[model samples]
Target: MQTDSKTIYTPFVRAKDSVWEVMSDVLLALIPCAVISYFAYGEAPLFVMFVAVISAMVGEFIFAGIFLKKWNTLLDGSAIVTAILLAFTLAPFTPWYVVAFGSAMAVIFGKILWGGLGRNMFNPALVGREFMTVFFPLVMTSRTIWYNKDYVNFQDLNIFNFLGNGGFTEYMNSIFFKPSGAIGEYSVLLLVLGGLYLLLRRRISWHIPFGLLVTFFILLQIFAFKDIKFSLGGILLGTLFMATDMPSSASTKMGKLYYGAMIGLVAMLCLLNDVKYEYMSYSILLVNGFVIPINWVFKPKVWGENINLKERVGAGVLLTIGIVATTYALVYLHHFDLVRYLIFAYILIVIGRFSFSKQLH
Candidate 1:
């Protein structure tokens, strides 16, 4: 009952783009954000990024020597991409050692241990960022770390006050010019442009990011319209750069859409519960576990492959049960209660199905 793992690497059937080219393009796209961070925060952010990149390269080199026993794959640029991304998720003043540790963890545990690059199930950068957040919450979330005496706070602009109401100004600031945040998420404008560059280069598809943004926008409008301006930068950064990671994300067209929507739903639920700093990263990681199953469920029909009517019926039944549980939980219980209920129901159905198959055998 296992799905074909090889088919889940990416959706590109015949693209001539190499991994190095794509990674190079990504790094190019990130240059403007990096420059903005450097200008705003002085040399601290640059040092952090430099340390992370070195740490990642070293980790990959050592792992390649030991496990892979081949050096050529190290030139693919994925390690550097992972390193830059991990650094982007950190505060500008993050300690050098901490940045190095997180970068190493990202390369060694998240990527290498999972068989590297296209075989990994989760985003390596987010894996590193999550580790840092868990182990160094004080360092990661320190308000003082976000401040730079050398630069003016963009949120305190007089023109912004005259632009619109307080809420509108705040929303615009969050989307366009947040003075304080992770190094790479300073401006949603730059991120959107970068995402567009990737799209134009044919390095990534629009489905995953589009699905995630649209779904999250709908959810906010429905349940928490007032807090719409709260985390626009984080949402945009994650949806554009991290969640769209090809190897760790969904492959099939429909599966990619559902996968992204699921991430959005889980993220909104996390936000509703006040899990702000880790919501987007945690949501992506959570959905990574389901990508294989999602691909299986939405697999394209092959010409000669047999279709299991009984299995299809069982899946339909599970879908029906999930819908009913969602409605009941959303109406009568906490917002997160729907997730818990669905998990419980899914576990029961899986166990029951396994037992039934055994009995038949």
Candidate 2:
């Protein structure tokens, strides 16, 4: 007896979930952070969120109608997420008009120009933040603008000093409840909660965030041991919320590791050199531009396929050269105190790589 086989059409097996559902989950994950920001910073943060979200929705609707010829695409909820994220990156006291403009830029230039949602090469919120940083540098980095009544005095308080001064409880409370820095980055505890929620929902994988954060912590500890909180806060905000962005991050598992390591390396370079304003945003965006190439190079392996030894060797050599050259240039040009430690770190990494390669062989 012969059996007939059936093949499903284009979509194959239909997904029980939709774009709207994924976006909804992301928004839900963000709610804890949103509530914390509102309570910490008072009404300004709420207003910023409101303006940003509304502006993003309007921009998405108009742009989708004009370019995609489909207004219904706004129902996917991406625009809301973009707006909220962009707002989070902004100062709580940033003018309402600026928030609106940034939201529009995120939707029009960042998303629509790249052919809508999934096609965008960079995260729309980050693009908006970058645009503002370039054009409104003073506003974006203004100390006066960032300060609120709830702000804590972080001056002269490195992580070590904060702990040694018997202010550990105060420091922990500040990290959890006090408003400082960006509108959304105020509460490390809330951000962790939100990140955990996303992880549990399987909306995002652990690879990128894990690699980026671990690399950043290790490098930061080696270079700036006193400022552990600064590194921790940066990793929590940038890795979890920004670097793991779905559209811009690496696709393959191995690619994510490389992508995240690059992000951490670049970010450390910025931090070590005192490039204070928007360094994390810049690092992630720079890596975002390289995601396609990284994905191609670290493409997912096929089962039972032979590995290309030549390609792997060539890549290894190029990476070593890149690291050595970068370190040499930094030491030669800037002569920064951290460069010496970085050189030591690179040597250790090289040793580790060779040892691992030998074990594999």
Which candidate number would show the highest lDDT if scored against the true structure?
A: 1
TM-score of 2: 0.78
lDDT of 2 by residue, 313-358 (tens): 6875676356435544553433443433533453365346545754
lDDT by residue (tens digit), candidate 1, 15-57: 6778888899999988878877765676888888999999999
- lDDT per model vs. reference: 0.74, 0.71
Model 1: lDDT of residue 221 = 82
**Model 2 stretches astray by more than 4 angstroms:** 1-15, 150-168, 225-231, 316-361
Give candidate 1 misplaced runs (Cα > 4 Å): 1-14, 150-176, 225-229, 304-361
**What are the TM-scores, per candidate, against the unseen true structure?**
0.78, 0.78
